[model samples]
Target: MGINLQKGQRISLKKEAPKLEQLMCGLGWDVAKKKGGFLSGLFTTDFDLDASVLCLNQDGKIKSNSEIVFFGNLRHYSDAINHMGDNLTGAGDGDDEQILVKLPLIPQNIHKLVFVVNIYNALERSQDFSQVENAFVRLVNLSNNQEIARYTLSGNGYQGKTGMIMAEIARVGDDWEMMAKGEGFQVKSLGDVMKLYS
Candidate 1:
């Protein structure tokens, strides 16, 4: 069936929706100085960082140690899908990982796609000390390379913590939409992030 989408319309999906064919997820952050810096860039600087999209999966179930693709810059990007090792760090400008998941075809069972931020290292600190910002995910139609839906994590709830987020992307009528939800935890490792699914 053909998918229908309206221009500039925001869509949200439920958790139990089918998986999408081509998924395009991006991670971004805002790097601003928290305090004053030196004229020569030698002073202490703070960044208002936030990870927008953390968790995203197609209709198929994401297994352990999957290769997820991380594209875009600290702010945004157009080309390149950087491959990252599972449980690794994509820190710094233009640092990201693209995860490739292999799953069995489950027909309509793979209806929803979930996006999350793996906060496995920022639980003990306070929100102000936490540096996760501007994270988000988007569904792309592989057939046309068109972005169908997207979601973002904002506000104080996303200030600081080490955990994963849950965003559902499902088919609405013919097109798709994104539903974002925050799930906090004292994540110590990637195993913890995987535990959410288990």
Candidate 2:
């Protein structure tokens, strides 16, 4: 059957090992200006970066290491970068670093799933003011992995930098619906994402 979705309907998944269809996935972030001065909002605070992916499954849970790949440019780190072990730091210029995720098989009876961004480590460092904060995620229905919808996060402020961009995804009818929720703590690692639902 085909998928049907409402405006604000919640999604649920209840089976194990559901057939996951990865639609369109990508990453977007705001880069600080190079020549701009102090008042230009250049090197005052952290720079915001967000990465995301899309998936649909019978089960609600995804593997921890599911390969979530993202395509972009190396505006920051140009040296010593490759398919694996790419370090994305607050430096250089434009967009850099292609993130990947290996998701786990989801659980049954779960309607929606979300992935978040964390920036606790960036917050503690004073010298790392160039790193941006409040990045987010979105999921689109791609015929061959193209763009579709935009799931933007909430609870963002001028000073509120570094946190999770909630990827609230739900199974609407036979298809899926997602909402970008920017809440919770600034994660330092992927392992900290486990506390999202808790």
lDDT to native, each model: 0.41, 0.39
10 residues in a row with least lDDT, candidate 2 = 74-83
lDDT of 2 by residue, 1-198 (tens): 222223243333222114444343333444335456666663455443334332324454443333232223322121111122233443443223233322222333344545444443554553221244323343333333333444333332434345554555665666444544545555554444443433
- Count steric clashes of candidate 2: 34
Q: What lDDT score is found at residue 178 in candidate 1?
A: 56
Candidate 1 segments exceeding 4 Å error: 1-20, 30-32, 37-95, 99-113, 123-130, 170-177
Q: Which candidate leads the pack in TM-score?
A: 1
Worst 10 residues of 1 by lDDT: 71-80
Name the regions of candidate 2 deviating beyond 4 angstroms: 1-20, 33-87, 90-110, 127-136, 140-142, 152-158, 187-189
